[model samples]
Target: MDSKIVLITGGSSGIGKAIGIYLTKKGFTVYGTTRNLKKYPDFTEFQLLEMDVREPQSVNRAIDVLLEKENRLDVLVNNAGVGITGPLEETPNKEILNAFDINFIGPLNVIKSVLPQMRRQGSGLIINITSIAGYMGLPYRGIYSATKGALELITESLRMEIKDFGITCTCLAPGDFATNIAAGRYHAPVNNDSPYKESYGKTLNTIDQDVDKGGDPEEVAKKVLQIINTKNPKVHYKVGALLQKFSIVLKKVLPDTWYEQLLLNHSKK
Candidate 1:
């Protein structure tokens, strides 16, 4: 194909939107997935298609729409996910399930749906958006970290499984970034009776502060472009400030107690 086709989930805004625009400018036909078509108007640069990653049928339908026109998929980016903050005890089971549905299972659905086409094409790229939190637990956001960690593990095994078919699976672990996800994050209600009320509020405040001062989304888009251009991309790509990126390294080099203390100190507002 003259134009390589790219499908990126959660493309309504944030990093996903930026990535779609960047790839489109690079001469690739980009298809972006959004749950709500009304929210995102027509983009001169790329096409926005309706997709709910949480539903297998919806994911398949969205990919089918692209396959019908593009004929082949060169890249599939699983960037659609949700965030949550709450003490495990205080957080409802429903909220936790919803988070996993969107963050973990949602990507799984897309990956499984797109594999058949990619296999037939004989080559493709699957990029899963993970987080530094995946490397270590983020207290109030423990479930979110678990979801990312799970995705990271899956991508690793998936790469090993699909390498023979000329398909590549990579995980992109990013730190805080300037995005609209903060305002929409799921936060459990903390009342006076809750034991973790004060701590949860403090930890969440610290996390929010980092997000407020996070890196630009354009940087992330640039990194995605770099990955796409590489002939052989690594299984894991980390993008963010040195301070945050280094934390993953530090986690490996430091003792367990030291690492825990570091996280505790950093998360305390």
Candidate 2:
């Protein structure tokens, strides 16, 4: 563990930065990627490389730089993502695509760039930081949920496909955590003229409040460390408030309509 090499995307801030800092203190050589290095000129927790997950060439270049220096990448954490919320009908097509590009395709690009090196190492772990919301569709967060939910399914398939190559892939879905996500997410403006004005506006406030009152990001960092130490990790793991994690279970056992109503009631609060 002292010599493990780890790469975490979006490591400049939020959950990614927390994880990188924790791992570095635990004796791991951690490198995190950021879209803009200048924004974090004061970031000293770990080294930050420049990379745009939406661009394959940029992703490759950043990983190449890491590989050339460390010669091995023992872990890859797909923690880079952006949140989007709106009524599907009201959301712009371009915003929807941008959400998927950054939250879904972006991670895929990073994974594709990192896989060859992991394959050569004959041992590696890929942990995707998804969201508990991914397990269900909330009223205004359908697009964000879809992006994370898609990544969860992809991780399931990826694990089996790469098992023979001595590599492992898994998803860790976190519930609301106090972070900069709410500040950075693309929120479709509340249109006073739109039909969803009342409901969408209320739901948007609830979403932001949840994030504001969320748990510390270090909780997620600790979970990542646990996953790294485990010899055989599960296909999916979740860390969040009890009610939030229970929501996934509710979705599984409750009738579809009943679960829908439960979410509706919760959101209205």
Using lDDT, give the best candidate's number: 2
Q: What is the C-alpha local distance difference test score of each model?
A: 0.90, 0.94
* Stretch of 10 with least lDDT, candidate 1: 37-46
Please list the residue runs of candidate 2 whose C-alpha ends up more than 4 Å from where it truly belongs after superposition.
none
Clashing pairs in 1: none
C-alpha-based local distance difference test score of model 2 = 0.94
Task: Work out the TM-score per prediction.
Answer: 0.97, 0.98
- The runs of at least 3 residues in candidate 1 whose Cα sits more than 4 Å from the true structure, single-residue gaps closed, are 42-45
Residue-level lDDT of model 1, residues 26-140, one tens digit each, is 8888898999888767655689999999999998888888888878999999999898989999889999999999999999999999999999989999999988889888788
Tens digits of per-residue lDDT for model 2 on 89-121? Answer: 989999999999999999999999989988998
Superposed by TM-score, candidate 2 places the C-alpha of residue 158 at a distance from the truth, in angstroms, of: 0.6
- Give the per-residue Cα lDDT of candidate 2 at 224: 95
| Cα RMSD, each candidate | 1.1, 0.9
Q: Pick the candidate with the highest TM-score.
A: 2
